[model samples]
Target chain A: MKNYVLNNLPERTEKPRPFGVTMAMDKGLSVREVEDLMSIASGYIDVMKLGWATSYVTPNLEAKLAAYREAGVPTYFGGTLFEAFIIRNQFDDYRRVLDKYKMTYAEVSDGSIELDHDKKCEYIRLLSEQVTVLSEVGSKDAEKIIPPYKWIKLMNDELQAGAWKVIGEAREGGNVGLFRSSGEVREGLVEEILTQVPFEKIIWEAPQKSQQVFFIKLLGANVNLGNIAPHEVIPLETIRLGLRGDTFNHFLNQSK
Target chain B: MKNYVLNNLPERTEKPRPFGVTMAMDKGLSVREVEDLMSIASGYIDVMKLGWATSYVTPNLEAKLAAYREAGVPTYFGGTLFEAFIIRNQFDDYRRVLDKYKMTYAEVSDGSIELDHDKKCEYIRLLSEQVTVLSEVGSKDAEKIIPPYKWIKLMNDELQAGAWKVIGEAREGGNVGLFRSSGEVREGLVEEILTQVPFEKIIWEAPQKSQQVFFIKLLGANVNLGNIAPHEVIPLETIRLGLRGDTFNHFLNQSK
Candidate 1:
C-alpha cells in the first residue's frame, strides 16, 4: 500500500513506530462505535486508553478489548483504573483481570490519589516482570503539582523499575496538567525535565491541535504524543508530515 | 418511553418541533460514522447540512443520505453547495439529485459567490415552491464583509421570498460571519439584525461553546441554533438547559 498517508513528507512507519504514536482515549465509545472508528482510522492509532474509569461503567470489557486487539491496536485501561484497584488493595486482582483480558500493557499513576515514592517504585517493579508499564507524571486536578525536579526523579525511578514510557498528563482538554489555563505549555518545566529524561521514552499527552503542533515543533516531527481525540488522528498525521497549514508553514520557516 | 434527552429541561419535542431545533453540519463524516453518531445523538438533531462543497467530494452520498433519512434527520447540502450549483447554472440538476435523495431542505446562500439582490431573491422564490428553503446571510471568507444593514436587508428579503429559516452563517469555527476573527459576536450587528428579523424564524449557526452560550444568554434558552457538531449536541443541550457550568450560574442568577 503506497503508505496510507499522502506524500511521505516526514515519512513515519506503521505500528511499532518509535515516534509519532497517536494514543486515542476512549471515554465513552461503545464496542460497535470503536470498531467503526478503528476500522477507518486504526492505521493512525498506536494505543487506545479506555479513558479514566469509563471502561468499568461499560457492560462488556472483554469484547471492547478484543475489538482493538483484533485490529492490531494495543489496548489498556486508564491509570485511574489502576489507581482505583491499588487504593482498594486489589493489586493482585488487577493483574489477574489484565491477564484474563490478555492486556500486555499497564498504566501506573498517582494522579487522583497519593502514593509514596517507595511504594510507587515497588508497584512498578512488581508489574514490570509481567507487562509493559506506562508510568505517569502529574495529577488530575490543579490541587496537586509535582515539582519539575520531583517529577523528573519519579520518572527516572519508574523507568529504572522498568516502565516502557512515562506519560506527561495533559488530561482531555490539555489544560489542567503541564499546560497553563490558556493551554500554553510550560516551556521551562519541559526543558528542566527533558534534561533529566530522554524525550523518546516519554509520551506527552497533547489533546489539542495547538499542543500537538507545539510538541512537534519543539521536539521534532517524531515526538511521541498521546491523548489524541478520534477525529483528530488523520489531521494530526497531516500536521506531522507538514500536510496541514500550521506545520506546513512551520517547516517552511525552518528551511530558511 | 422516557424522553430521549434526560431531564428534558427547556423540553423540546422530537421533530416537527416548533422551537429548540438543533441543526448539525455534516462536514463530510463517513456513512458509518454518521450512523453511529446519530444512533447515540440524533434525538437532539433535526436538520443536517452536508457543509459547503464537502458533499461533492464524499464518495458514498446515497448510503450517507439513507442513513440520515432512516434516523429521521432531514439532510440538505449546504448553501455553499447551492451557491456552487447556481454559479455553474446547474440548479436543475442539483434539484433533481436532491429529490433523488428525498431531501426536503434547500439551503440558498451567496456565501462564496456573488448574486445580485434581485437574482438572490429570485433563486429563493424558485427553490421555496419545491423545498423548505433555509436561506443564509453573510460571506464565507473574511475579506467579503457584508455590512450589518445589508445582512439584515438580505435576511428580510429571503424570509419574505418564503424561507423557512434565515441562518446567520457562523461556519464551522463560529467565526467570520456575524462574528469577528476572535470568535466574539459582533453585538452591534446582532442588535441591528434582531431588530429586523424574527428570532424564531432565524437559525444562528453557533458552532463554538462560547458562541452557543452567548446566543443562549442573549436570546433566551430556546433560540433555534444550527451547525452544531454531533458530539456537541448533548453539550449544547446541557448549556441550553443550564445543566453545564457556563449557563448554570447565569440561570441561577436570573432566578434570584
Candidate 2:
C-alpha cells in the first residue's frame, strides 16, 4: 500500500478538496457494495450520487446511506429524483426524506421536466439554506441542446442561488450534456463555459474514459468531475495521476 | 430479496446454465472488492475474467482469486496474459501460478499476439487436458478485420481442440473483434458464425448495454455474455430479465 508507483504522477489537491474532486455515480449499489467501494476506492472519490430514481427503488436505502456516510463520502439523491418530487407536487415529502436521511448535500435539477429557470434557482436557494446544494444545468435529452450562453447564465444563476457547486449535467451515458452523440466534448461550448464559470465551481459529469482524459489534459488532474461509474473510480484516479496510457505522458510533458 | 418484479420478464436458464451466463471483467480488483462484488451481485455473474495483464499488476491476487472461488464464481486470467507468458517461454510458470490459485478456468487467446491457428489450438488442447479452456477468436484491433469464414474456422478448430467455450473476441471496450468501431455488432458476421458454431459452446463478449440488448433480442434471454463491468452485473441481469426500459417490451412482445 505504501509503494511509490505513483511517484512521478501529478499531485492531486488533497481530499476535502474544492477542486480535483471525483463524484461517483451509484445507481443502486447494495450496502455491501458501498462498503467494498470505500475499502478499495473511496480515497479516489469525494461524493456519491445515487443515480436517477435508484433511491426510490433500492431497498435498504438507509443502510446504503449509512455506508457512504461511515466512509466519509457525502451522498446525494440524483437530480432526477428531485425532479420527480417536484413534478409530483410533494416537495415537503422530499424535504422530510432528506431530513430523515440527514443528507448534507442535495441536487436541484430540471433536466427531465419543464421548469422556469427562476423557479429552479428559487428551489436551489431554499435547499441551500438547509444543506449544501449542487444544481445541474443541462437537459437529459441529447436532442434538447442548451446554447453555451444559456448554459453560462443558468450555471451562474444557480451558483448565485447558493449552490455549493454547480454540476454540468452529462447523464450517466456521457453523451447527453456537454458532449456530442459520439461522446466528444463540445470544444467551443466548453471554452465559453470556462470563460464564464470558475473551474473549481463546476463538476463536469464525465462517465467515459475519453471524457476523463479530455478534462484531465485540459484542466490538469485537479478538475472536478462527476457521474463516474463506481468500478471506474480507480481507473479515473489512474487517468488523473497519469498512471494510465491515455495520460501517461501528460505530467511528463508538462515538465518540459 | 424475493420481490420478483421481473415476473413478466424472460426466464433465464438458471446457473449451471448452458447459455445464460454473465462473465465479469475483473482487471486488478483488490481482494475486498472481489468479496464485495460476490456479496452484492454474484447471483448475476457466472465467471470472472481477470482482464489483460492485470494479474501481473495486482498484489494479493491469491486472496482475490480465493474470494471468487469461495463465492463459487470461477475465475480465469485473461487471454493476453497467456500470450505474455507464451511469448516469454514462461507458460509453465503461468500454469504453476494457475495451480497456486487452484484456477478451474483459463482463457487461451491470440487476439493480442501472433499465434498461428494450429499453435493456438494446440495450447487449447493442452490446457483443456487439465482445466476448462475458453479460447477467444479474432484480432483485438478494430482495424484488423478477420473474415466471417476465418472466424468460423478458428472457433470450430478451438472447440474441436477441447475448448469448453469459444469466446468471440471483443475486448472489454466492446469496440473491436466482433463489433464495429462504433460498438455496433456486425450482424452479418454474427449470423454467419451462429450458422457454423453451436450456440451452447459460444460466449459473446457484449460489454455495452446496447450490445447485450442486441444479443438478448436476437439470441434470446439465455445468450452467454462476457466482459461485463463489475457494477453492471445486476444491471445486465435486469436487462436480461426485461426489468429495465430497454428490454421491458422485449419479453412482453415475445409472449404475444
Candidate 3:
C-alpha cells in the first residue's frame, strides 16, 4: 500500500528524528500484531519497547528482534527487565543475552528497584559506547514519589553520563508519574523539570489523549511522546500535525 | 499455539460469544490496519464499529468489510453514520448501502442530531426487524446536554421498539456522555436509567480505562462494555475477570 496522508497535516521527518518521535510501548503484543504495527505505523513509530518484562515471556525473541531490526526501528526490553536482571545479579548475563539477540537499545530505569547513582552512571557510560541507552526517571508506584527537583537532577546526571534520552515514566497508564490521577500534567512539577533539562533530550510518556494534547500544547508539537497505545499512533500523529480537532482548534485559538 | 491464560488469568470465552462480548471502535483505521487488528485480536473481538463516518474516508471498505466478515466478526458503522443519513434524509439509501456491503448490524442514534421520542422509537422499530440494531443515547458534544429523564425514556422505548441493545454514548473518549469529564459514571443518571431498563440490554460505552473499571465495579464483571479501543480488549478482559492488579486487589479487599 502507498503512503496515505490522513489530512492536510504536516509531514513528520523520517527516521533519525530529533523531535516528533513516537515510542510505542508494547505490552505483550503478539508477533503478528507487532508485524502489522511495523508495516502500518512504522512511519510514525521511532522505537518499540517490549514493555515491562514481556520479552522474557515470549520464546524465540530472536525472530521478533530480527523483525524490528529489519524494519530499521530499534527495539529494547523495558527498564523493569533490567531491574529484574540486576536484582538477580545477572546484569552481565542479561547484556550477553541481549547481544546474542542483536538488540541495540537499553532502557535503564530504577522505577521498581534501586540502583546506586554511581552504578547507574557506570551502566549508562558502558552501554552508551555500545548502544543507545534511554535512562528513565520517576518511580513506578504513586507513593514512591520523586520530587521535581530530584527528577531534573537525575535526568541531567544520566544524560551527562552518556544516556541518549531521559524518559519521564508514566507507565502504560498516564497517572503514575508526572501526571496527576486525573491525567493532567502537574504543571509545577513539569515546569520545574523543564527548567533544568533540555526539552529535546526528554521523552514524556503521555499515554492518554488529554495528556498528549497537554504536552503538545505546552511543549510544542515536536515534544517526544512515549508509551502511546498501538491503536492511538495515528491519532497522536494527527494531533501533533494539527489534523485533529483538539490541537487544530487549540493552535487556532492560540494564534487568534 | 494453544491459548495460555493471560498473566496466569483464567480463559475467556472465544469469539461467537453469546455473552462476554467485546466490540472494538475504529475511528479511522486503514484497511491494512483493520486487517492487522483482526489478525492479532480477532479472538477477543466480536463486533467492530467503523467509528463515525470513518468508513467514508477509508478506501476499499468492501474488501475490509469482507475481511472482518470472514474473520467471523461482524462490522457495523457507528450510530453517527445513521444520524448522518437521518440528517441527509437518506435513511433508506443508508440501509441499502449497508446491505450492499453485507453489514449485518446497524446503529440507530441521535448523538449529533435531535430526534423526538416518537420518531426515535419509530426508527428503532424500522431498523430492529431488518438487522441487529443497537440504539444509542446521550450527546457527543459537551454543550449538548441530555436530561436523565429523557435518556431513560428513550432507552426503554428503543428496547420496546425491538432494539437488541441500548448503548449509552461516550464517544471515543468516554467523558462527554453518561460520564463526567473525569470519566466517572454519572451515578444519578445511571440509577434513573436502570429503573426503566434491563441492565443486560444496555451496552455502556466506557472507552477510558478508569471508566471500564468503574462500570465493572458498579455493574459487575459481566457488564457489557462498548467503544473499547482495540488494543485495550485483553486488558479490559483481565479487569473484568479480576486478574489485573486493580480488580484483583478490589476482590481481595472485599473478601477480607
How do the residues A147-234 of candidate 3 rate in per-residue lDDT, one tens digit apiece?
8889888999999999989999888888888987768788899889888898999999999998898888887778899999877786
Model 1: residues with Cα > 4 Å off, grouped in runs: A1-10, A181-183, A231-248, A251-256, B1-23, B27-30, B36-177, B180-184, B190-204, B208-226, B231-256
- Report the TM-score measured on chain A for model 3: 0.93
Worst 10-residue lDDT window, candidate 2 chain B: B1-10
Q: List the residue pairs that clash in candidate 2.
A: A20-A222
Candidate 2 Cα errors over 4 Å, as ranges:
A1-24, A28-49, A52-62, A68-169, A177-179, A182-256, B2-7, B88-96, B141-143, B242-256
Give a tens-digit lDDT track for model 1, residues A133-205.
8889888887676689987998898899889889998888898678987899988888899999998888999
Clashes counted in candidate 2 amount to 1
For candidate 3, the per-residue lDDT at A200 reads: 90
Clashing pairs in 1: none
Worst 10 residues of 2 chain A by lDDT: A1-10
Each candidate: chain B TM-score? 0.93, 0.96, 0.90
C-alpha displacement of B65 in model 2, angstroms?
1.5
Q: What does candidate 3's lDDT look like per residue over B1-256, in tens digits?
A: 5466345343455556655677788765656777777888787787888776556534456777887878788888877667656755777877786777777798888776778878988988887777898888887677777798888877888888988888998878778888987777888988888787788788889899888888777776777889998779879877987878778876555556
Better of 1 and 2 by DockQ: 2
Full-model lDDT for every candidate: 0.80, 0.84, 0.79
| Per-residue C-alpha lDDT of model 2 across residues B50-135, encoded as one tens digit per residue | 99889888898878888988888888889999999999999899888788878899999988788888888888888987789999
